[model samples]
Structures are given as structure tokens and as C-alpha cells.
Target: MARIRGYVEALIAELRALDDGDVWMLGGGRLQAAFLERGALDDIEIYVMPEIIGGGVPLFPATGLRLSPKLIETKALDKGCVYLRYNFS
Candidate 1:
């Protein structure tokens, strides 16, 4: 497992070259939003924490950009955390 950090295009190219199973984006919601906005991601796995907080960062921060990801799978974890998997359509 190698971690590549550089230009987004470079990372996308490397990932495409690898063509291995699923590529996971650990965090950085801004970066994730950018990738999704640029059509560089195939699927997204979002972990929802059961809580209500004020003034938190938004997941999809791109202005005026909307994405409707198809539901692929969902897993309910302990402590009220739910994992939702969606594929870009």
C-alpha cells in the first residue's frame, strides 16, 4: 500500500494505472468534494456519526454542484454509526 500525494491529475493517473479494486479516501472532505466534482471518483463510502453538532464542515462544499450517488450498500456499526456506500452514476 503506497500513499501518493501530489497533483490531483497525477494521483488520478496513478490510480487509473493501478486499476485495483476500490480506492479509499480517508478524510479531507474538501479534497473529496473536489475529486467528486471533477468526476475523478467512482464510488464514495460515507460514515455518518449519530450526533448533532453546530458549525461543522460540509461534506459536499462545491458551490452549486449536485451529485446523486446510487446506493450500493449500507452497514450499521456500533455506537450508532452508519456506513453508507454509493456508486457514482
Candidate 2:
């Protein structure tokens, strides 16, 4: 996988200029939240495990922000993993 390391603002600026292809942001909930807030996120794809771990990081934190995503697709993978795809409308 290719990687680019830079300040958050620079990274988001570069991401905003892309007109084609998919950009995948790995991990870092804070960064993801920033991108979502800046209108840089197109779709959110997540993998859900069966077991519940206590005190895990929140996907959408409490900032009075709301997103209405349409459920586009779902897949049940091996080892009780569920893949969900949501299109932000």
C-alpha cells in the first residue's frame, strides 16, 4: 500500500483535490472525524466483529453532528465478521 505522511491540513487539501478513484483512510478516529466534518468523506465502510469489547473508540462522537447514510450493501465474512457499506447522501 502507498502512504503519504504530512500535516492534517495538507493531507486533507490533497484529498480534496482528487477527482477520481477511492481514497482509503486507515484508523485514527480523530482524523476520520475531521475529514467527515470537512465534507471530505464520501462513503464509510466498516467491519464489525461479533465480540463486544468494553470502552472501545467511538465511530461518531458526541459533537452534535449528524450524518444520514443510506445502507448500500452488507457482507458476512468469515469468523463472524460483518462488512457494512454506507453511502452518505
Candidate 3:
């Protein structure tokens, strides 16, 4: 998983370079978990979509991960995409 570590390091470096008032929208739970397992993420969010996937690529792959999150905010969108924020505790 050297590639994953490189990505995590690069992302953390970019994060360290950001100002205090920047917002980064992170997607992919399993991908995020990879970074989180390396202690690279301090915050996370999951956007719930109204549309159901018939059968395609899975987002949250079946992984043995347990992440307890606190709902920080929820946004109701008119375009069938709802944004859900949570504190990755």
C-alpha cells in the first residue's frame, strides 16, 4: 500500500498548507477510511443521494471498519442530492 501512503502524505501536506477557513469536500467512505486508518483525517462527511443505484460500482465497499460519527449538519438539496456532515469520532 505504498501508493496509498503517498497519497495520504500528499493530502496531509496540502491540508497543512491550507488557510484556517478552507473547506474540503471529501467523498468515498472506503477511500476515506484508508486515509483515516493512517490517522490522516480529522473530519469527514457523507452525502446521501436520493437516487438509488440499480447496479454499478459500489461506494462504501464491504469492509470491516467501524467509524462512529456525529451528525454535524444536513443540507436538503432540490436536485436530489443531500449533503450530510458528520464529525469522525
Candidate 4:
């Protein structure tokens, strides 16, 4: 666990040093949550579809961590989908 944390820290540092544009993580909720927990993620973008599944993976896992990010923008897409953007402030 410690080694993995070190690796994540290094990766975040490297990305920050680049001074590039946004970094997108097309990973699952668990992976995103990991970065969020480490204060590495500045913002998050979520896409909502118009389908209902009985059971599936959550957008963000239950890690006993709670946060209230400011909603930056919202766009309605085709097929009844919506895009949500939130920033950690």
C-alpha cells in the first residue's frame, strides 16, 4: 500500500511538472477515488446516461470520504444524456 501511494504521488508530481493541459483519467471509480483522496484531482467530469441498470459499479465508490465540489457546468447531450463538471474548491 505504501509503495502504491508513493507511485501515485510520483505520477501526480510528474504530471504537474509538465504544465500541460488537463489530464483525463478514463479509469473506473476506484482509481478516480484514489486520486481524489490524495488531493490530486482538481476537477471531475461525469456523464449521465438515460438508462437504468439494476446493479453496476458506482461512479464513486464508498470509501467513507465525503466531499461537496462546486458544480462548474452542465450540458445536455443527445439521447437524453447529460454532462456534469465539478471543481474541488
Against the true structure, whose lDDT is highest? Answer: 4
Which parts of model 2 have CA positions greater than 4 angstroms off? Answer: 1-6, 18-20
**Candidate of highest TM-score:** 4
Name the lDDT of candidate 4.
Answer: 0.87
Ranking by lDDT: 4, 1, 2, 3
TM-score of each: 0.76, 0.75, 0.63, 0.84
Better of 1 and 2 by TM-score: 1
- How far residue 26's Cα lies from its native spot in candidate 2, in Å, is 1.1
Model 1 Cα lDDT, one tens digit per residue, 24-70:
77767767876776798888888999778767877766568787889
| RMSD to true structure for each model, in Å | 4.8, 5.2, 3.0, 1.7
lDDT string, candidate 4, 3-80, tens digits: 877888898889889867989887778778888998889989999996787887778889998999999999999999
- What are the lDDT scores of the predictions, listed in order? 0.78, 0.76, 0.71, 0.87
Q: Tell me which residue pairs clash in candidate 3.
A: none
After superposing candidate 1 on the true structure, give the runs of residues whose Cα lies further than 4 Å from its correct spot. 1-6, 19-21
Pairs that collide in candidate 4 are none
